[model samples]
Target: MTDYYGILGVDRDTSFDEIKKVYRKLAREFHPDVNPDPKASDKFKEITTAYEILSDPEKRQRYDLGGDPFSQFSGGQNFGFGDIMDAFFGGGGGNRGPRARMRAGQDALIRVELDLAEACFGAERELNLETAVACEKCSGSGCAPGTKPNVCAICKGRGETQQVTRSIIGQVMTSRPCAACQGYGSVISDACNECAGDGRVRSRKSIPIKIPAGVETGNRIQMSGAGEVGPGGGPAGDIYVEIVELPHDFLVRDGNDLHISIVIPMTSAALGTKVSVETLDGSREVAIKSGFISGETIILKDLGMNKLRGHGRGNLIVHVEVTTPNKLNKEQEELLKSLAKSRGESQDDVEIHHRGGAHSSGFFGRFRDAFNR
Candidate 1:
């Protein structure tokens, strides 16, 4: 008195195709290999039994008429193997034609070293690499001159062999790729000597690579159709070029911004002066304001790295370090003392203040803010 329709979550009037579709979904969900629940195995068995009995038109009709269909066989009855194969594997349990020898190739990757200037600005390079290419001797056909492939006699160009065997589920039909043909349906008896029937050969060749600006270390550039050729001279795969940026002599890069430190005389910082610094664009003079403290920054617009996949450029942040006269001569010391006295400062006069607290708007403040920035 098993209600197969109720077990499959379908009404009695449901069509066989609808029943099979539901069974496929339930099977994928409850199959032991996929579902971890212990009860799912028994649930899968119940659903599979429900589908097998309900899928057949005669079984469905007999069950509808209140007759027992399982009474005739002590073991399981016969069902077409294609039904199970199709339900589980998305169809194609029947005869399949030969597979093509040519297929898309795999992607390849390589790393290249670049200098700061080269990375900041786009550049082209010609590099040599060993990769697979169409064989010149065989013209990518894999056959020698004036010779061609022959149809496989074992599978008769079908590329597969089928057999039926009795199992717990009754007769089951199975098919596999033919060993003789290797699924190609044809055999290259007279293969090209240079390529050894693969239709391609490995050789060293030079290819040009164009690197975009602002590419950082570990950034990859993809070149389509620049990889290894396929087995039978099919379309080549893509080539990925990974960048390794070399350290610059003076400039430190952070994203698109560039950083450089420059030392200036204390007098120049106090009195204000323009100092020429070397930038990627060329030598540029940066103006220091009067009373400018050490550790302050000067930003030069459009002087950093060129923007990658974008417009314009970044800024060059110049860090200033004022060099105090450590060993002042007698005249210089006297002059500094006189200037300090004129500015109301003396040897014994002292003012104690915490950094970045109440009084933090002068030389030390600017210096701390510079480093913090």
Candidate 2:
């Protein structure tokens, strides 16, 4: 008698929902799709069957009463020693082998680099990749040219062999893949020279890939049927193209928003001006407002990268840095001093002159002060 709770690694008093959750989690972890381990797949199937039986009130009650629920004439009774398999697989018999060679191949992964703008706006590129493709000369068959496979004598074309043996405890019976044909039910006397016994050959392939807009680093793009070709001409696996972003000179991307910074003359800070700036779309003039404080941000709406998902676009934030004039001449200094006198102020008013002075209020004012000397 198998302990249902022990099989699922759960407490005896665990709730039905908890049992289901644990079973699903473990099943997903050990599923052939993820683990691909034969032993793990069997364990997962066992646990799944246990949960299915125990989670049902009637089935659990019947099992608890020890009524010999498994019937020899029923679907589960003779299902190969009362071992009920999952619906995802075939019946009690082992998987049938091909007359020739047959098996699917593995997928492949390739890394690609994209510029910030190209990644944001989406772009097309050609990829040179190496993978296993079906052998054209043999048409993915392991048999040599103009030849075919022969039935295995061990299993008589059944792909499996059954044996009965007497042990110390009692007599036992088991069925397994035929050794002569390795369960393929057939033997290839002359294998394909190109791919040897297997029906696949290694070769370089050129593929076109389209990267969607707003794709970030480490993102993956999947191409179906682009991976290694399956054995015996079976369906191909998938190809995953991983994205890597290149650092931009003037732009820093954060999700959807774009951050840009540039230095301008000090005079532009005092007086209004329009400076031409480069953006992904093209060059455009951004207004430098009158008395524009250093480090002030100018947000250009709908000018950033297109949203990776959803509608609309992100904002482009421009950070301004005021560049003060250097190498002042005597006449220039004198004119500045005269202008300061006319304005009824001197260099002592430096604190008050800058919008980001110590006495300034508001968030922008403080932010500007933090950015300046």
Judged by TM-score, which candidate is best?
1
State the C-alpha lDDT per candidate: 0.76, 0.69
Residue-level error in angstroms, candidate 1, position 294: 1.9
Span of 10 residues, lowest total lDDT, candidate 2: 75-84
lDDT of 1 at 140: 55
User: What does candidate 2 score in Cα RMSD to the true structure?
Assistant: 15.2
Q: Local error of candidate 2 at 58, Å? A: 41
Name the TM-score of candidate 2.
0.61
The residue pairs found clashing in candidate 1 are: none
Q: Candidate 2 — which residues are off by over 4 angstroms? A: 1-101, 145-147, 154-185, 309-311, 346-373
In model 1, the runs with Cα more than 4 Å from the true position are 1-97, 162-174, 327-334, 352-373
Q: Could you tell me every candidate's TM-score relative to the true structure?
A: 0.64, 0.61
Residue 301 alpha-carbon offset, candidate 1, angstroms: 1.3
